[model samples]
Target: MTISSQSARDLTANITALSDKSVALMHQRSMSDEAVTTFQNILQKVQEIHDPKAALRSLSAEELDVVRQAHSLAESINISVLSDEGAANLLNAPGHTKDLNNDGLTTIGEGNMLTFPPDNAPASFKAAWEEASDGLSTMDIPTHMIFAVGLANIGREPGDLNWVNPYASPDYDYGAAVSEIIESVEYQYNHNMMSFEQYQKNMSFYNTLTEALA
Candidate 1:
């Protein structure tokens, strides 16, 4: 029902450190600006930790079963996947006009529910799954089922459909959240907004400095 705490100290450290950067990103504005490239790096890290088969493997049996159920639900719908070109172009489009800094950060315990187009739901889920697959079949059912779903969703709605660990909640729509991160980074990368030297560096102060903090 919970993420594998194989090394509670390391996992806590990673999550605690990553959480601040995630919050800083939540309020960053100016999708047109070069900071967006940093946003891209952050997004990459999130999917890096959560999507790959290796990341999925880190999940508890119950957590993965929950994700598998979500994967199956997503597959049941006919997803109108965009071609590579279309997806590439769409990912680079402009986003919110105004920047934001609410002067407050949101912990996982708190978030606002977001809405997504029904038409795009399946594709978004598929994209998340694909990013997680890392060339392996994400749909391969494992040998056993210890529990039906994670305890986090024990009393929730029948089909909230957001089943990836930690972020799976009725309050926060992970798919929509990912679209925002993707579009910002894609815009900067596609437009050559950051210099090669700068682009190659991890510019997010929060992430880079966290090790020092810890």
Candidate 2:
């Protein structure tokens, strides 16, 4: 990441804020409280990072995974705004696509960006995508289907088909997949991201008519 002095400080503030917000949301969602508290306590080690710029990549890969896991915990449970912009300025870098998780696919960046699988994508990747995306309109819920496909394997090479299975999945188990669809459909409705008919259609995709109307 090309760093200007101003941008470096901005990124620092963003990461710090994201960390704080992430912790708060974890509590609201009644996540594994003891575990979340312990995990964040470890993040305090970052305070030893004196220089804002130095703090950018100061985290080891494992540590970085911890942070992402924390945020993704909240995200896959429902939806998350934690990745908005942070020490992860990589999303803002001009013309650069990075697989932050080193999952081999770099297209699903912050904000759940997308790029189709290469034709040569492994059989596993194709299969995971196909299963998660089955029977859904590629153009419509391709983005939303991401949750069912497994947020952890967004670009994971040799993708795991069980990415959606709770016991084997990488996402938090506090909610159901259809709950995500329900929440997103309501969010779209409240925010006017879609029309009423479209919102109904989205909800009905996974929920029964009674549930959708409810």
Best by lDDT: 2
TM-score of each model, in listed order: 0.18, 0.28
Error of 1 at 162 (Å): 24
**Tens-place lDDT digits, model 2, residues 124-180:** 544544554467775654345344335545465333442322223233322355476
Structural RMSD, model 2: 16.3
Per-residue C-alpha lDDT of model 1 across residues 1-214, encoded as one tens digit per residue: 2223232222222321224343344334322224344434333343435222334345455443332232222222111332222111111112211001110111111111122212123454434443443344423311111122333345554224543233333344544444454455456666998565533332232122222223
The candidate maximizing TM-score is: 2
Give the C-alpha lDDT of model 2. 0.43
Model 2 / residue 104 / CA error / Å:
23
TM-score of 1: 0.18
